[model samples]
Target: MTDFDTGIGDLAERLVTATRTGDHDYVADVLAKLAADDPRTRASALLRDLVDTGAGMIRARTREDNDALYTFDVTTEHDEPVHVDIVPPAPRAALRALAASLNRDAVDRDIHAVLATRGTPDEVVTVLVQCLLWTLELRDTRTPAVRLNCF
Candidate 1:
């Protein structure tokens, strides 16, 4: 994995642990780090609201045929549930090659095309973080499927 992937994975793990333990300060810290960019800023805002409202149960599942597509479910204190499906960009190697070979506009267009089937920025990011966490958990446990009951 690239440094970017490693960083995101670490952040995903930390966010999961913090949320599970009800560590609001740590969650805020993670959200602050994630809010550095535009889309992530919006995503972090949504996560902050959800965490504050005690909606920390994040579950992720990958399709049997396609590991690239992930489904996430989160339920709030009031029992309001939010679901999102996210298909992350191309593989890191492919994306890196595209970035190196193409212009900024072309790279943007390609990425946009890959992400066109998503939901809001917040939902996408939220689901992505959960998905990353699930992958890491799967790796550690060697399980066929993992359910993150880390509320």
Candidate 2:
């Protein structure tokens, strides 16, 4: 089942509660809660983590110089084989888009149009990730790693 089953409102309530704790492990605990028995939920959480990490880098103005990129296998909507090789300094928009896709209200009308056009929520997320992946796939250099699985 997707987070639609779990309810985004409940997730937001938990997140608000977690942030109030001001503890470092709050994110991990919340992620564990979201990851319960659902691979897509875990994948969504992982993508959110990547976006958060990239936002941190943007805030710190840090640029990594390395050749190691993180890779993950993603089964396409059509059951085709694919992989994502992520590098450091992930795009802020990509991360925000992933997060917004979950909440349903934060993303623009275009994303909503996907669902209105008969696309499932899961498929919308997969398409978002794949679009971001395609941009990264064209990148020849690499630094750092971020992995998330969606199948």
Candidate 3:
């Protein structure tokens, strides 16, 4: 894996641990770090996109029951949002889906080709729509109280 992949994987692992223990503090710390570094300006941009797209502050849980799985609770700044299951780690199926998703004829193949080669977590998110897509799907399936929806 590339450095970006490694970093994201590590962060994902931390997220998982935090969830298993129900440690919101750890989740906040991770978010804060991402917010502080603002690597590739992804953290804030992602947050903005989430809010604009109707997603709210997300609380993620990396469950002990499954290694390749994660769950998120999307709550607003004041209201409780919803829970969304996610697999932050790149799995074969997700990759295949990602390859297909990025295969749109209207899209700039050159950009995604470069992004795939570069292999940064931020780039992966951009290319695969991983986090955002996963959040939306999981929320709908898992929670009924949530009113937010995005594609």
Which number leads on lDDT? 1
Name the regions of candidate 1 deviating beyond 4 angstroms: 1-10, 32-36, 39-121, 136-151
Per-residue alpha-carbon lDDT of candidate 3 for residues 1-151, written as tens digits (9 for 90 to 100): 5323444545554554554467866665555445445233444333323322222222222222322322234454566553433323222223323333323221332233333323444434442344444444544454434333322
**What is the per-residue lDDT of model 2 for residues 1-151, given as tens digits with 9 covering 90 to 100?**
6433565445443443444455436544544443343334443443443333333333233344344222233445675664433321122234334434333333442332223222344443444344324323323224334333332
State the displacement of the C-alpha of residue 112, model 2, in Å, after optimal TM-score superposition. 13
lDDT of 1: 0.38
Which digits, one per residue and each the tens of the lDDT, describe model 1 over residues 31-118? Answer: 5444444444344333322322221221222233422323334444565673322223322212222232222234543343234213
Clashing pairs in 3: 70-86, 72-84, 74-81, 75-81
Each prediction's whole-model lDDT (CA): 0.38, 0.38, 0.38
Q: How accurate is candidate 2 locally (lDDT)?
A: 0.38
Per-candidate alpha-carbon RMSD to the true structure = 12.1, 12.9, 13.4
Model 3's alpha-carbon lDDT is 0.38
In candidate 2, position 129 carries an lDDT of 44
> Between 1 and 2, whose TM-score is larger?
1
Clashing pairs in 2: none
Best by TM-score: 1
- Give the least accurate 10-residue stretch of model 3, judged by summed lDDT: 54-63
Total clashing pairs for each candidate: 0, 0, 4
